[model samples]
Target chain A: MKFSIQKDRFAQSVQDVLKAISSRTTIPILTGIKIDVTEEGIKLTGSDSDISIESFIPQEEEGKILAEIEQPGSIVLNARFFNEIVKKLPLDRIEIEVMNSFQTVIRSGQSEFNLNGLDPEEYPHLPQIEEREVFKMPTDLLKTIIRQTVFAVSASETRPILTGVNWRMEDGRLVCIATDSHRLAMRKAAVETDSDAEYNVVIPGKSLNELSKILDDTKEPVEIVITDSQVLFRAKHLLFYSRLLEGNYPDTSRLIPTESKTKLELNTKEFLQAIDRASLLAREERNNVVKLSVIDQDTIEISSNSPEIGKVTEQVKSRSVEGDELRISFSAKYMMDALKALDGTEINVQFTGAMKPFIIRPEQDDSTLQLILPVRTY
Target chain B: MKFSIQKDRFAQSVQDVLKAISSRTTIPILTGIKIDVTEEGIKLTGSDSDISIESFIPQEEEGKILAEIEQPGSIVLNARFFNEIVKKLPLDRIEIEVMNSFQTVIRSGQSEFNLNGLDPEEYPHLPQIEEREVFKMPTDLLKTIIRQTVFAVSASETRPILTGVNWRMEDGRLVCIATDSHRLAMRKAAVETDSDAEYNVVIPGKSLNELSKILDDTKEPVEIVITDSQVLFRAKHLLFYSRLLEGNYPDTSRLIPTESKTKLELNTKEFLQAIDRASLLAREERNNVVKLSVIDQDTIEISSNSPEIGKVTEQVKSRSVEGDELRISFSAKYMMDALKALDGTEINVQFTGAMKPFIIRPEQDDSTLQLILPVRTY
Candidate 1:
């Protein structure tokens, strides 16, 4: 491969692909990034078995030439060193050439680097997914959906399927759900689909987390293609593929209570800050549990007591409280996570008695919901 | 302590004293910060044996009352938890009261915390240093001197004295030197002393590092009092005490080269960047050795070669070359460290021979000098 490309453009593409590269991969070839220079553009690919990313830099962009290719070829370069060299090079343009024995030479200004390249043929090929069922959504929307649900996914591998977020199509809306057995987060959004076909797939939460980072916050559309065992996301010049979990996801719809014994509406920021302070003392304890008790009709008391370290009590004013009086205890971390994901000035919390699961939702929008199972502190 | 203080001021003072609290200390009370509320003001102290910091918040500063004392008492609270509580409290003014059984109640707005406070009598007392000889310098200058020399100190504990920076008063100038035997950095500055007394002491590099962090970059003078076993730094309302390293520092004056076989003047930034790029490849090797060879009267080539990963070569323009044509190899990290310490647009590097030590100094200032030993590359 012989080509000269704009240094900044190449650096960005390399960074995007690096998200899929894992230094601890069992496969040796997977540790390197595959670079292919073709007539169309330059493609850089990185994979770590579970996810694969390919970022393409076009030869010409917006009537301006970004790359000039003299020969068409492919090679695999160590991702770690290649990335460092590209980021630190002091020049506007970079020239890369592959010679005999896969010797790659990179030059920019008065600096030149010679790296040992491997045969690109040894790298695994990306999974092929038939585009029979595809959905499109704005990049920012997809990012928001991922952020709202991914954090609730089970980090422990005891139940492998629970480590992924379940995506399903119900009617015309797409719903994403994740739960760690203690708490659950769900988000629903409207998507453009080619058919009325319903689909359900469990994608590893880690994959979604990485995808969210690479997705730009622009209004541009991202096309998603789903198959039996794989899913592909294509956006402008980037393609991301992730493997689907091979087990059934637990049905979590029934876990969220539909009825409420008590309801309270309060400012989101104030409630979040109250729980954050309560968590400071609770964190010293193993369970990180904090208690919330309704006082009178318009105030809520949040407190956490550590037998050895002492206790903290905070009173937060609520806009309105209705139904039965209640006191509930739950993980401060879980409540904080749920509160942060709901983007609203005010939040409505519904408690179905103290022992049962409680639900939290944005007072303005009902598309996002969070549920937490209270711990029996008594 | 029973008092109400401004939250921001209390938080800042708590953070400053926290630098002296080490979680890994053997003494349990050392992990806690002592709070003393006297009629005059409130004082916070944290110590980790090697270093101790005391920050005082007076009742009134410049006619503004920062704290109101309701009761006079002393207690020690866990630094980790106290800092977190102080930082997250939701109020402008904080009220702290010591109740029966040493149960301290901290209140701010509607938030309250009850912490288990230890008896202040159990906490170790700060070392007392006699005010025999004292030197004064701008806090910013002291911070600058520490930064310029601390990085060269030996990180290994094999040579205890080498792990500390040697401070000596020579010919009315305060000189600081640090060396790991491989490289050395020395900085000198004039200071106002009460007497023309000659003093020599080795202060632990780690203590100096923390001291630099707490010292504000202002024109306020920091009074440094030196004793036989301890050094006390007093600035405004803050007092910092550090135990001196007990050992005889080796004489490093003979290590500096007096004559030079070759001399080169180059832009400091360009030379630093060239070495930085060369180090990328050198890092792959065990020794991290980079070679610099003068190509002609005004050009030098910096290069590093890893047999398995290939090599990198960079050509940097020099302002002037004198004495002789030479090629030498050295640790890229040490060279980068020395280059970063010198504050100048251009630097003058004097090489004694291919295998001997070389000196690097700023072209415009004689206050600081760096000497590096060359690595013999066969």
Candidate 2:
């Protein structure tokens, strides 16, 4: 391949593809990025078996020639070294050319790098997924959905299926849910699509996180295609593909509590800060548990104790509280994470009992919900 | 002890003292910060045996009441927990009170903490230094001197004395030197003293780093006192004590070459960037070595080759180059560090030969010098 491209735009494309490359992969070529040059543009591909990312840089855009193609060819270069050299090149235009025996030359300003490139034919081909149905959603809304639920996925590999977030689309809405057995986070959004196809697939939480970082936060629409074993997200100049989890996701609809004996409304920021302070001591313990005690109809107390260190108690006033006086202990980290992911100031929390899971949601919206199981501390 | 202090100011003071407190100390009591309350103010002290820091919060400053002292007493609380609690308290004013049986109550807004405080009587006393002589210099200058030399100190403990920076004062100027056997950094400054005292001492590089972080960047003067076994730095409302290294420092004056075969002047930034780019490949090697070869009177080439990976060559233009043609190899990291610490853009480099040490300094300044030993490439 012989072409000169704008330094900044090419570096960005390289970075996007690099997100999918892993140096520890068993396939040596998988650790490198494949470059294909054609009449249209230059395409960069990187994969680590689980996820594959492809970013394209066109020859010209908006009346400006971003790249000049001298020949159409392909080569695979080490991703780590290519990225480092491209980022530190001393000029705005970078020229990369392939020679006999696959030796690649990269020149920019006064700097020149000669790298031993591998044959692009040795790289494994990406999974083939015929697009039968496509769903379109706003990029910002998709990012929000991932942010709200992905953190609840189990980080352990004991049950590999729980490390993914289940995306269920039916009728005219999409629901994303993630649970780690101890807690659950669910977010609902109204999505627009031209088909009646429904998807109940689970995408790895790690993949969703990487996709979120690469997607721009704008109202621009992104095309999503789901197949039997793979899902692809298509943006303006990028294609992201992630493998779906093999096993079925556990049904979590019955896990959410339907009714509560105690209910309270509190300011989210104030309550989060109170739990944060309470966790300062509780964090020393294994579970990082904090207790909540209902003192009266209008006030409650949050406290944590570590015998060797100290004990902290904080009183937070609720807009309104009603029910039997109760005391419950739960993971302070889970509560703080849930609160931070929420968007509103006021939140309503409902408890079934001291031992049962409690549900928290925005006061005026029922779309986003968080549930945490109480720890047995009595 | 009972007092209410402004949260922000108190938190800043607590942070400063916590720098000296390490959880890995030999003495258990050293992990706790001692608090002493007097009619005038409140003092917080933290120590790790090698270094101790005391920060005071006065009752009033600039006609504003910062702290209101109701009782005078002393107590020591776990530094880790105290700092965490003070940082997250939800009010402008925080009240700390010592109750019976060494129990302390810290209250802010609606939050209260009950901590198990240790007896202050067991806290070790700071080293007492007689007020024989004191030298003063701008806090910014002190910070600069530490920044220029500390990174060159040997991190290995084999030669324990090399882990400290030697400071020698004679005439009206103070010189600081640090080396790791391969390279050396020296900085000199004119300082004013209240008494006629010429001294030479070695202060632990770690302590200077900590002191630099605690001192503000303003040009306000800071008082420095050197004793037989300890050095004391007194800033407004703060006292920092550091124990000196316990061995004689080796003289490094003769290591710097006085005569050179080749001399060159170059733009500091251009050469540094070239070296940085060249090091991208060299960094994979054991010594991170990069080579510089003079191409002509006004041009030079910086290059690095890794047989298995690749090679990079960059040509950089120099302002002037004279004397014998030469080629030398050195650690890219050391060269980068020296260039970053320099003040001006134009720098003069004097090379003795391909194997001997080279000297680098600002174009017109002789107060700061850097000597780097070259590696044998053939």
Candidate 3:
């Protein structure tokens, strides 16, 4: 197979697929990216067992020549070295040739690189998923939802299912939830989908993170297809597939309290800074715990103490406070994550009691919420 | 100690001193920063045996109130936590007060931090250097010299002296030389010093790197004071002292050949990029070796090969090539470091033979030189 393509265009496509190439050497062939030349265009695929990413470069794009195939063939080359070579090639155009012996030669400007290539047949095939349950959503909204909730997923492998984010669709809305038993984050948005179709798939949080990075910030709509086990998201020339966890996600609705005894509204940035400062002292303690106490109608106290490192206390003013005054202590890292996920300027935090889990949400909206279980401190 | 200092001034000083505090907590007191308050000013010091950094905030500067001290005393506090607290304090001015039993209270805005402090007597005292041998040079020049040569220092602890840079003065010319036995980097500049007094010292490379970072890029000159075994640099309100390594630094002059049979001049940036690209293919190999061969008076070939990973060959147009054609291989990392040290449009490389050591210098200036030994490739 022989082809010539613009250096910049090829480099970007290579980079997108290279992200999925396996870094683990258990499967030696998986370390390489498979490239296929077809009559329509060129397709590149990279995959580990958990996730796979594929990108296509059409023969012509916007009346500009992208690639021309002399013969339809396939080959696999080391993903990392190939990407580096393409990026550093000093020319506007790049020429690639694959010999009968699976030897690949890449040339640009005055430089030529000859790399040992493996037969594409030796590479694993992309999972076959039917598009019968296809749905569409804006890329920007999906990226935001992923970022807002992915951070709360459990990093430990004790409960494998908790390591994945739960995505469910009902009515005409899409909901994403992630929880590590300690803290939970949830986001919901409207999307155009089959009214009769519903999805309750759990995708690994790490895989979702990698997918979010590859998704460009564009207004273009992404087509998502779900099969019995795997999920596929397609946007423009890129195709992303993630393996779903085969287990039932925990019922998280019961974990979120339905009632509250006290509620306070404060600017998100102000509360974040206060907690950040309080965290300085708390970080020296064993659990990295910081305490928040509602002193009066308009005053809130944030404090942390370590026997050896001393203590810090800060007073932050709030717009309003009601119900019984309460004090709660929780991990500073968890609080920071919950605050970062919040988008609005003001946030409403509700407390059931000093020991019960409290919920935080945008002051004006209830579509997104974060819940943190306080730690008991003497 | 009781004082009020501008938050910005205190924060910057804390950060400067924090650089000298090592993360290893073998010495508990060494992990703490010493703060001394006087009617004249406030001085903060951090030390880890090998190096010490002290930054002072005067009571007043240019009619502005930098620090106001009501009591004169000193205390030591955990440097890491203290720096973080000062940086995040939410006030323009910070008030610090020391109470009985070594308790320190720092207040800013509506936030207050009560920190446990250690007795200042437990802190190591800064060595007093005689004022006999002193010189001054621009902070920028000192940073430049350190940056240009520090990368060549040996990182291994086997040959401890090679981990330091040999600094010497001859005929009012200050020269800094560093070599790990495989490669050498030298930087020379003229400084104001006593013509009759010549000095030589080996300063630890790691210490020099930290000193370079702390040196602000200003026109102000830094005073250099040499003690029997310690070198101190005073700049503005900051005092930095580093213990010199004992024993003799190897004579590197003999390693740098004075004559050559072949020489080539090439664009610095272009050569660096070519070497960077060639290294990609050689990275899989143990040595990361890249070969350079003079093809003619105006051309040179750069190439690398691995039996399993294939090969890369690139021809770079040389500005001028003289003498006999030659081919030599060396570590790509070494060549890149040399090229980075010499900031010039064109760099001249001299090669005595294919197996001998070579020297690289810029065509416009002779203040800096880099040398590398060839690797015998089968």
The candidate that wins on DockQ is 2
DockQ of each: 0.89, 0.91, 0.88
- Considering just the first chain, candidate 1 attains a TM-score of 0.99
| Candidate 1: clashing pairs of residues | none
Q: What ranges in model 2 sit over 4 Å off?
A: none
Candidate 1, residues B162-189, lDDT tens digits: the string is 9999999977799999999999999999
Count of residue pairs whose backbone atoms collide, per candidate: 0, 0, 0
lDDT of 2 by residue, A250-297 (tens): 999999999889999999999999999999999866479999999998
lDDT of 3 by residue, A1-378 (tens): 888888888899899998887787699888998999888888989998678999999989899778877788889999989999999999888889997589999999889999999988899888998659678888998898998899999999999999999999888778899999999999999888765698898999988898999999988999988777899999999999999998999999998999989999998999999999998888754578999998998999999989889999999999999899788899999999999998999999999998889999998898899999999887
CAPRI verdict (incorrect, acceptable, medium, high) for model 1: high
Ten contiguous residues minimizing lDDT sum, candidate 3 chain B: B191-200
Query: How far off is residue B4 in model 1, in Å?
Result: 0.7
Fnat (0 to 1) per candidate: 0.95, 0.97, 0.97
Cα lDDT tens digits, model 1, A254-365, are 8989888899999999999999998998885648999999996899999999988899999999999998989899999999999999999999999999889999999879
* Residue B88, model 2: Cα distance from true site in angstroms: 0.7
- Give the lDDT of residue B354 in candidate 3: 92
Show the lowest summed lDDT stretch of 10 residues, model 3 chain A. A279-288
Q: Where does model 3 exceed 4 Å of error?
A: none
